[model samples]
Target: MSIKVIVADDQEIARTGLRMILDAQEGIEVIGEAGDGGRAVELAQRLRPDVCLFDIRMPRVDGIQATRSLAGPGVADPIAVVVITTFDLDEYVYAALQAGARGFLLKDAGPALLSQAVRAAAGGDALIAPSITARLLSAFAGAGRSAPPAQPVEALTGREEQILAAVARGRTNSEIAEEFHISLSTVKSHIASLMTKLGVRNRVEIAMWAYETNRVRT
Candidate 1:
């Protein structure tokens, strides 16, 4: 089945380019386009697309607001959202991820990453721009960067700890499985456990928590 997507941006040209890029990808379709967050939310709630590709700055509502409406915590049956923006500023990246975005990509992330983000989001996986993954976290860590990260909720098994480190480094589940010589389902189980233990909603948050706690060092 095709992965349906909604593209939302304040600029018509940007929206058009994003739509074109997504439409050209195999198994991906841009089903709707919205110039503002209000319409973006309305179309999303009604159309129920597989993914939402949103720009951070919009007229009525920004991408973060729109994303929160569709996918934030406490939202039941949330839609998948991937934020694509020109700004790779720390605030925007953190805000979008905290708003429950499944992925974040720069406008210059190129067609390959754009399509990959859509596919990953549609498949219930999270992707942060590789170029920003490690640096984005460590750059903002401050003086606490050297401190060891505290374990969360409960003690993590040795395997879980390894999984957490792998995830913190932005490795996909398949990659983690390959690295650890485990099954894909096993990797997923460990990730799910990590999310529960860390009190996070997604892998992006998992990575953030690791960085914040100094678990994943520079």
Candidate 2:
């Protein structure tokens, strides 16, 4: 099935561009477009698309609030949201992730990453632009980069530790599997286990936990 998506941006040009890109992809479709965050939320709640693409700055509600309404921590029926913006600021990235965005991508990240982010979110996986991932975490990792991990390090098995370290470093599942000479399924299994143990909804949270607890060096 095609991954149904709602593209939300204040700029008509940007929305059109995203729709063009996603429509061209094999299994993705831009089902609706909203010019502001309020409409974005309304369309999302009504249409129930598989994924939502939001720009941080928007008239009326704004992307962060819109995301929070749809997928925030306390939301019982969260929809997957992928934030795409040109800002690239630390604050925006931090707020979007905290508001329960499933993925974050820069506006110029190109068609390939855009489509990949949509697919990943639709499949209940998370993807953040690698460029932002390291810098975003490292900026806050300094005060106590070596502090004790948020979760007991000993709680994880040896193999789980290895996988957690790789995840903290922003390695994709396929890359982790190739690096460790293991099957992709095994990598996913380890990640699932890590998420359960850490009580995070996605890899981004796992990465954050790893950094907060000093599981991986910045």
**lDDT of each prediction vs. the true structure?**
0.85, 0.84
TM-score of 1: 0.91
Worst 10 residues of 1 by lDDT: 141-150
RMSD (CA, Å), each prediction: 3.0, 3.0
TM-score of each: 0.91, 0.88
lDDT for residue 128 in candidate 1, whole number 0-100: 79
Error of 1 at 71 (Å): 0.5
Residue 192 displacement (Å), model 1? 0.7
Report how far off residue 63 is in candidate 2 (Å). 1.4
lDDT of 2 by residue, 1-218 (tens): 88999999999999999999999999998999999999999999999999999999999989999999999888988999999878666466666776788878899999998998898889877777777776676555434335544564338999998988887776777778999999989989999899889887778777777767667664
Off by over 4 Å in 1: 139-151
